[model samples]
Target: MRDRIKTDELLSTSDLRVSTAATAWRHVEAEYVDEIDGILATLAPSGPYAYTVSPRMEEGKEIPTQRIVTTFDEIAETYQNLHRFAAVVAIRPVTQLHASWYTFVSGLGRGREKATGQESERPVIVLFPTMGSEGITGELFWGRTQRDSMPGDPADGSLASRFAVAKVHDTLLDAYRSGDVDALTDLAHAEIQAGLRDYEADTGTLAEMHTREELRRHLERFFGRYRVLGIDVVTSHYDDWFFFHELRWTVESRTGDDAGQTYRYHTAEYAELSAEGKIVAHIGHGTDRISAACPGPA
Candidate 1:
């Protein structure tokens, strides 16, 4: 299809149906591009809240799996995101085709109802793409349940407490990703303890990064080796006085000679706050499933 819109001309949609009709615009890749690079948006004549991810199908599986690749939106949207989430995934078409398949969809996280603004889990769309004799074939799943949840009611404790931890959550995330050890130490207490591991793979008890100095050195070493490409949020929520977040991230190596090699990884982090809302303990687990081939090595 000769149809192509410069990224600037496109208005992000929240009601558009993602289907064969969108194939012509497959070149319309969003910055939020995923697997097959198919174009997906959420919009419809009904309103801005409607979302759809295409090749609507009855039964199928996501290929390479859908990982949270960015979290800025989750934190930016403040607990209500599903109504406006967007994503793309790779999948083998339910109807086999000689051509390759890819999908683009919107509405990954959930939004809250209007009357109460009380948040509840909502479904996001997953769309698929396929090439056929007729051109492009579509597969889609509707009402796919979402895993992210909003912070619990402040009535359980106090708005001050909830907001404090939420803010701390934001701050600590910033520090962790930026490798700002000084910021981490300032946010965390003197006795702060940190643990990191992989949820899907057991690498052992993790390094004993119990002291601020250890944490600083560990982060410095990590930042020295890999350059973070991007980070996506799979889930971000708060419970009691604790905050937790799961991320799907991509990082490229900058150390040694494999500087350009990229690795896809996922991690979950949990942090508990002291009575004063200072982070006391932080634990993280990560996994790198897909092996990346660096041109230089064996």
Candidate 2:
């Protein structure tokens, strides 16, 4: 029931166009385009977005040449290696979605947050999609993708509770960005549970502090490590018990062996708030983008 969005009218299938005239390609192209139009009609009709088609690429021919492909399964296989996907063909967008060509690329992946589309400071709902076993099936296989960063409808939680934690979030975010260690320390309760620093590795505790001074010491080094910075709130959720976030940010090292390095990192945080609105238990986790050398001007 949740997946079924109510729309007054379905987007016209004839409105979409594919570059290829091949019957084989048309079969799959129509399917993909229709799915997108359904999504737009319900969630973002006339919204900013893009759709692109890329043909299979070959060697020893012109720099930009399309090779013949018989089935849609080929596209699924190539999606595994992103470079190979690009090499397969150029990505262009449906002209109506975006006014400028550049915006289309940004929406596709050139510079997306890999989480929720909303900007900073908005409370996000934690929702995932569920499908039935009755849709047309195929050999299509796409490896797990963070590309579907946009969440579905909001999960179960009251807005009042979310706002309660958001107040603290705003303060913590502001303090961290401004490098105000004292203010950050004051925002937390005397006791803390620094969650796994590397959530993926699942190592030991990030930091377990019983006093504000201890948190302050940790904050000093943590906050001082970065110079120029950027933050984007991808998807977020409040499940009645805790407020959580999946986010990405840009940072340049300031002091340490890796001092000059720049990183675009993905992180998540789960915070437990007390009656007084101070963060009592905080779990922080994230990993740096090794491939993203240094974030530059956008």
Candidate 3:
């Protein structure tokens, strides 16, 4: 029996993080600090690359502020810090989110904080995508997240095949991009549920839809407001039960106060699929700072 079963079959978990877009991030962070130059070379062009973190705030009602570090020089300075080299622990691969984009949560020790005897653990989120020859280009976020669960065993043999998940996902994306409501109806189950958790919104609302009819209405409202310029799947991961993908979208507002303005958004979504390969549940979250509004094409 052992000889007949494949090596992966013996493992209880289905984490493909080592093979996903997170590979370069894991490599760079795990290597000796002196190897930073070679690792930085793996990042995408420096102009667009960014590293951001949530500002430290006192325990209270004060809202957190964002501090972004751009430019290769600034990014290098942060990575070269001695404390930045601390070992990463408790890594959890967040799947079923971005199409081709992927992210993981891990803990890194912050060097000497106040009078603490030992380094304090800070949660870090490493978000990345495979950019052609750039390999794994990532945006490292420190102190943005406070908690995450550890990795777990794979689904109990109930997961769908990669091919099945990818096929439906591609069709759905095409339909969405084209505003093909009929095609979308064919792809969604009668009991479909969908929602968007727009983190960029000040209200922090998770807008939801419970049935195909509700989804249709929601999509109609969305299409009415914005004309999708493009949607590029940056990276993705899937199993029998869930398909996770990160996508970058460019759209122009058609009906709001911001009409005639274009914006670029980075979003992640995870969809739960039924046995028949139809989407039963879909949840999405906005992942990045939206680009400044620009004039739409004439």
TM-scores of the models, in the given order?
A: 0.43, 0.42, 0.46
Q: What is the C-alpha lDDT profile of model 1 across 262-294, one tens digit per residue? A: 777666555656666666556544543344543
Tens-digit lDDT string for candidate 3 (124-182): 33445433224444454434221222122245233326566777888988987887888
TM-score for predicted model 3 compared with the true structure:
0.46
Name model 2 segments beyond 4 Å from true. 1-158, 196-205, 239-241, 289-298
Candidate 3 RMSD computed on C-alpha atoms after optimal superposition onto the true structure: 13.4
* After superposition, candidate 3 runs with Cα above 4 Å error: 1-160, 198-204, 292-298
Which 10 successive residues of model 3 have the least lDDT summed?
144-153
Question: What are the RMSD figures for all models against the true structure?
Answer: 16.8, 19.7, 13.4
Measured with C-alpha atoms, the lDDT of residue 181 in candidate 1 is 66
Query: In model 1, how large is the Cα lDDT of residue 23?
Result: 49
